[model samples]
Target: MVKITNKEAICIAVLFLLGSNIVIGSGMDVQNDNWIAGIFGFAYFVPFAFMYARIQALHGGKDLPEIANHLFGRVFGFIITAVYTWYSLHVGALVLRNFGEFVKITTLTETPLLVIMLSFSVIIIAAARLGIEVMGRLSTYALPLVVLILVFMEAMSVSQMNFDFVKPVFVHGFQKIARAGFSAFTFPFGESVIFLGILYSLKKRESAYRIYMTGMVISGIILVTLTLMNIFILGPVEGDFYFPSHSSFSRIRLGDFLQRMEGTISVSYAITCFIKASVCLFVACKGIASVFGLSDYRFITIQTGLIMTYLAFILYKNTVEMENWVINVYKYYAIPFQIVIPLLIWIRAEFKNRKGKRPKKSEELEINGGEQEEAGNEF
Candidate 1:
């Protein structure tokens, strides 16, 4: 039934949390203090992760759609599920578009972005069709390789890093750093809501708490380290670069031998991106299947992939537009699904639990009466 071990789940979660942030460089706008922003972002998201885990625990491995149905009833639950379904599909498309944009900017200048997106969609479709178990296993194996490459590259570039660049914390004041942290918190960290779709697939439902906390911490550390590396390597000019982590790696040179390790960075990016996209696609397919009462989610994977690929093309007209949306609009757009809806669900769950635990009026009256035969005893 598409079950996966906690380790596999962690792998998927970490990779999904890592996502394009490794390439996009989270909180880059804060420049030298981006690490601080990363810390704040991670801090802000931890509680939400905890809350999500609590929901999972309360529901006994039921996914979001099922939980919604149980908590909200048919009509409202279907509506909520529909919104979640759209969010999953929408986020998946945006991530695919991010990949397409990255390729078009860095590698395939001569090729059309649409073609690249479509090509990537094929792989994502296949992965989603294979089910969450296969994806989880793939993630378990691939995450380490990606992390190793990242650490190796970071180590090699260490010689070039200047610690001084990261100094003078809050030079632009705490406001800017806080804003960047808020932005960072929303895009990738808060996006963990999508995991609600697959949390039910865990072999041990209780592992949800460990999985969420561990995954978020690992990804947050990676993002923070990457941000620090960008500051150390690129310094003040880090803000000028779109993908600071990638740009930093490109600058790596050792003597007359080692140089230009963009390929390594590219491979790592592709691996993480593929894992993220696959998870999102799987979530979308599974959510849809649940909403429609389909027997299998695999039936809709390819069709959903096709639709997302097309949507990716129309998502943004240019890089500037995309960046503007990401920096300015996405955080607000994501709040409803990531924070608001989840908060509502948590509240409802709590209220229902309290209601169930409260004694009925008859029971309360009987207890208050304290022995109905007190009159006979007195006589």
Candidate 2:
């Protein structure tokens, strides 16, 4: 089996968290307070990382599906695995849809969504078939460049920023900020739970906690900083734009000659989205393979990618419906897989560990009797 170091795992996590986030900034409804909401959401996700780490620790090197199978019967375990597989597949489809929409609106106004999706699907399938180690290494190499470009864009935009626009904070009260926080937590932060599949490939299983936490912290900083940059540059109008980061970056004028820096955001977005979708696709393919006892996951990667592309087109009638579903339903809909099931499994694993540590009644009695005999002999 291929093994990934903690560093590679961290890179994967960072890019995965950035996947849709760079394209769709969180807490759009909360306006200027979106960055604050993101911070709170980051805090909310810390325990989840710990929980996922605990689950990893309990099982050593085993993935979530394997842990379920060991704790539950094969049938139930396979069912749980199937559920997670579907979740990954669904998420992959959503990301693809987001990509298609972004490309349609911004870059290729003339192209059909289906053709764009097909081109992306072919690329995604090819990447997924290359396997996890390749994906991890690609993230390791690509993330630094993408992040650097993003930072440069933010720096360039700083000259045009007006921090005054972010003034009069909390004017809308904490309720809206709290709601945005919840949205941030469920959509992106909680989505990290999908990393459970890739965690199995880590070379140092004991370092999973550190890897998860580090990745979250780094990505959280980037996300919050980007949001703040958007607020500063775009002011109250940030929320008005669908892709504020791109809009903000486009406003960056470098020396009057180099103006359109939106391409920086696009590059980072594409790279991050590729990493995120690839991870989801990899997990889905890998999980399905585990369920069916297949020796290789690549066997199904293309088929799954094609299905995901189709699902992307048909998932919503239009972008408005898609946005509505995301705002109204997605947060609640993702709970079971993200928090509920993992928490249950973690609880069960802890209970089993505690039970295993305790001596049986018969063993306790034998120990007492042996202690009494030892005392008599000493006397």
Candidate 1's C-alpha runs over 4 A off are 359-379
Winning candidate number (TM-score): 2
Error of 1 at 28 (Å): 4.8
lDDT, model 1, position 351? 89
Residue 195 alpha-carbon offset, candidate 2, angstroms: 0.8
At residue 115, candidate 1 shows an lDDT of 99
lDDT of 2 at 73: 72
The TM-scores, one per candidate, come to 0.94, 0.95
Query: Candidate 1's C-alpha lDDT?
Result: 0.87
For model 2, how does the per-residue alpha-carbon lDDT over 234-321 read when each residue is reduced to its tens digit? 9977877777888888888879698987887888888888888888898999888999999888899999999889999999887777
lDDT (Cα, tens digit) per residue for candidate 1, span 180-208: 88888887999889988898988777899
